[model samples]
Target: MSEELDIPEEGTESLYERRAFVIDKGQEPLRIDKYIQMHLEGSTRNKVQNGIDAGFVTVNGKTVKSNYKVKPGDEIILLSLVNPEHTVLKRENIPLDIVYEDDTVMVINKPANMVVHPGVGNFSGTLLNGVAYYLEKQNPGLDEDSLPRFGLVHRIDKNTTGLIVLAKTADAAAHLAKQFFHHDVKRKYTALVWGDMEQDEGTVTGHIARHRQYRKMFDVYPDGETGKHAITHYRTLERFHYVSLVECVLETGRTHQIRVHMKHIGHTLFNDWEYGGDRILKGTIYTKYKQFVDNCFELCPRCALHAQTLGFIHPVTKKEMLFESPLPADMAMVIVKWRNYIANRKEL
Candidate 1:
């Protein structure tokens, strides 16, 4: 019998096709590639061998050769970019804000309200579809199979605007994936939280997991509890009495790490719909105060979070690469309003 391990979400780990299996006690010894081909439906021998060559298949948490023999009770794990579902991709000419691109990689400044990948309620019109169309235009006969997951190495939330990197080749994807898995990539986000932070800078360390009651939301767990370890270091940039603008640097990227960590400390991100930031969590209940808060929300309707900076080593060139994006107009305008509000309040 075999069991599949839970795949980590896009932001937490490399969003690859992952499958885990444990060999049955009664099973006879078989070649690793052949065993994988037998267990993974629709997988061909050639494909399995290629995956093995690319260090996608591992036994007992270690990469192995295709000829390695699998024994009973052996744990086998496969991580590939190729999705077994083979979902047909529809290329749409969606406009993309390309920050930088080269032979092996590309950087994009993703806007708010755009889902990064196609899923449940969002099937088409994702960043991936747009990337597919863009890649097709760049290389007329591009074989997507060679560029798994459109070379997406990491992900940001749908409402978060900022820089995301993409690889163009299998080798590049593998290299970049390794970097993300090791937490070597530099990611910095700008967030406006509900309340003023007492400290200028500090780190929030906790284990993060999906909420028990609300499956869509995540909560921070105590250490050694039911979740992956996450760390976020934040520095206050500008403080508005009702809210504070902070720069968050991710030490470990778990799903909703920044949002959850901020909320854990009594300062949920402003306008974060999923975490109750959309409501007026801070500030007075006075009509005038409420109106000002509502106006700020209207200026930036979605989560007031931006993935402002991303830095990584070039997969092929092995050179350090860093990119920065200014806060989106909506978020910037909201900050301006808050600045004005504080200025006016001081005058009074």
Candidate 2:
């Protein structure tokens, strides 16, 4: 028997597929939770238990408890959430800058302006859509329901360009998710922020939460009154007197952590329109200088941030893995412009 139930947003992970099974005629009794875990590659007993408690798992079309003992020829059905199957997922033929790929994981150098997944205003042309197409090629003749869903451990902003790792299998996704949750993964971002830094290095700690009024933006709640704990450690990479390029290491991953933390310290990312870095926040207001700044803005129109490096212990190898991507053309050009502007001013 098959049933499509209303998807509950909370208390459930994103589901990839629904599965049904029947106990062997001669099989002995086994706990439903353990039985499900044994059959599912990436699912744990706890996850199955959660499903059971939430009434996501049923026996003979009736919701059952985790400890329910299965009898011979008993019918079982599980509603697993997290990954949407291929039929519902939009597949695009977009090119992917694959950094590395194997049976377990894939790392891609995502470009600026590409959404990681589909949502609200972004219905297509996302990185995941492209990934679906790629995965379809790798696993041909597979049923649509059996196709692997996109396994994302973490995500960068829409405009933040650089390396993002994806799991190819259920086991890999579970392991990678654990690493991210425990803060075992190392993530580094390079950002060009407005204003000269008085200190060479510093750390920003605060609670980050959604803005009370602006639902689309995030803010740092300094009083620990709201939001999740976030930490960002930053060191000045190069200073251009008016603006500086900084490398930021994230201790905690929260929505807009780096962006909000930097802004909290009074150094907003350059060209970050949402955080008010798009205007002339530094340097002389002369016409020539204004034109120069405007030109730099045009050169790198998006937020001046890049996920430069990522390091983590490989789930399969138990060995360290590190990946890096150079600054894209837009960011590189703006950096050069800043360097020349600083040098020429010093010569005068």
Candidate 3:
């Protein structure tokens, strides 16, 4: 898997499985689900329903309703096949903001909202997809079936954009992954949370797990199941009456580690849609700040989260490197105005 494979050219979603062939010509008249079951192994009716909801299964180059019948020559694109575990990622001439690269590794300034790889609601336009193309363009001798060449070393949340690294060679990938597994890499972030923390610096230690009632969340409780241990260290960069700009360093990585931990500590990032942080500001606690946040809401419509810094030792060279990004302007006012609000309140 570390070896690169030639990815397919970047294009819009296709109707039929791009490279998958029909099980039999006689099955043409069968229902789409049945056709999928017959052609694609381990695919079932329930799996098809799940795929449809996830927007993975499509027909004739377009996503269609589940019950839609198929006709002769109608291409049946199985979204599942595009999965990195299934198909080789292909090149599509996608643009990238390459920060740094060498014989063994590549570093990128990943944009916000672009998932590192395909998952959940995002099946395309992922960093993996882009990297696949980049690798293909770099090495023409590489075969397409072995594509998706860039060896993914680590992953960052889709919304928390920042510096991310990938291994270009299998040896580099395995060595880099070992560093992560052993907690050898250093990672950092800058975020605008909803409230000023009590202390200027702190660390959160907790066991995290998915909520029983909610399908898409994590919780830390006294009686919670034994979830994975995660640690985050934070320090205040700026404080406002209702928010704080904090720098966080990860000692461990887990799903929604920062978002969940901050929310657990009662300071979720503003505009976070999933971890209960999305809302329009209305109070006059700081009108200027409210206006700023409201305007940003209109502009970006994402939580004030950013993986502003990244550092790790080169797997091949053993040299150290680091990268950083400034806090996006959308969440800047959360700190600027809140500082004024707190100062004015002190004046009273």
Candidate 4:
């Protein structure tokens, strides 16, 4: 089911307003108090717990305890604002899943379908928003131009899941940005695409730019607008009758770099229906799983891209650092179903 909600612009009296949400799978066991504390746009632990206590946070049309666990497909009504005060990013007693942190750098395993930073159509519910809050709350006057953003370095796409780095100081941010610019940050991705392998391994090297007609899309070109150079190395970890499991390595991180380059080749990722994806599954070789893929592409909305690994040098200590995230449930299930299809067809 699709939902289009326009938040009311009222409630200027209180900084935080109200919101509604319907939980998807894998979010079960999430405590009401803790979920609101972490996921609310700019809400703090005290505010969220208070909301829970005040009967504002209703679950399935009833007031529940703060310890109430959110089951899959549960309906949660969050009485909160889109973006609250304490500046762009404020620390609000939220817990971070930090993999590694030092004086200069931090590595985090970002969950899938999460935006790294705030941009258009996303002022909250972002890693950046949370990071900004964390920095402002931790260090007074930390947002000075000399040391902006608690040292956020490189970024990953909203739907593209993976590892990312953060800078606690300005020196670290600048240094890490330089490392990414020089293509020194080691990045890898795991994706299940919809195609048989022409070769067991390959590379797609090109420049990428925003699509001419499709404003939200990116495309590759032989000679396009001063686009940065990018290279992608991929190998079939496992091959099925129709699709292949590919491991992608990035040589340059550009906007939608890997997604665009991968599609530039004949292999569009299994769940990617954006770059010339017809709602009706296309491609002659896809006959095996076309119907199933069509149904999946319609029901499962997220793309199949995932940032499986990230590695870089510590901007301050000059030491190496790494982080990784596992595949999200929906994507994993898609692969599972497709694998079953391949095995049955193989037996036939």
State in Å the error of residue 273, model 3. 1.4
RMSD (Cα, Å) of candidate 3? 13.2
Q: Which runs in model 4 stand beyond 4 Å of their true positions?
A: 1-95, 144-150, 223-226, 277-291, 298-300, 346-348
lDDT of each: 0.83, 0.78, 0.66, 0.64
**Residue 76 CA error for candidate 4 (Å)?**
53
Per-residue error for 137 in candidate 3, Å, reads: 1.0
User: RMSD for each model, in Å, please?
Assistant: 3.1, 8.5, 13.2, 18.4
**Per-residue lDDT value at 212 in model 2:** 92
- Tens-digit lDDT track of model 3 for 124-238: 7888778777787789766543323236656777787678788776456545655665577788888888775899999998877777779687777553356667788999888
Per-residue alpha-carbon lDDT of model 2 for 1-348, expressed as tens digits?
A: 212243322111122334677787776788889888887667666666765775556788788878899887787866564443233566789999999888888999999999887666776898888987898888865333322332665778899999888877656765666577567888899999999988999999887888998998899886658777777899999999889999999887777788888888989999999999999998896899999999999999999999999888887998899999999999999999999999999542
Number of the top TM-score candidate: 1
- lDDT, candidate 3, equals 0.66
Candidate 3 steric clashes: 17
Ten-residue region with minimum lDDT total, candidate 4: 8-17
Candidate 1: which stretches are off by over 4 Å? 1-13, 17-29, 39-47, 58-77, 80-86, 148-150
Alpha carbon lDDT at 70, candidate 1: 89
RMSD in angstroms between candidate 4 and the native structure over all alpha carbons:
18.4
Model 4 lDDT at residue 314: 78
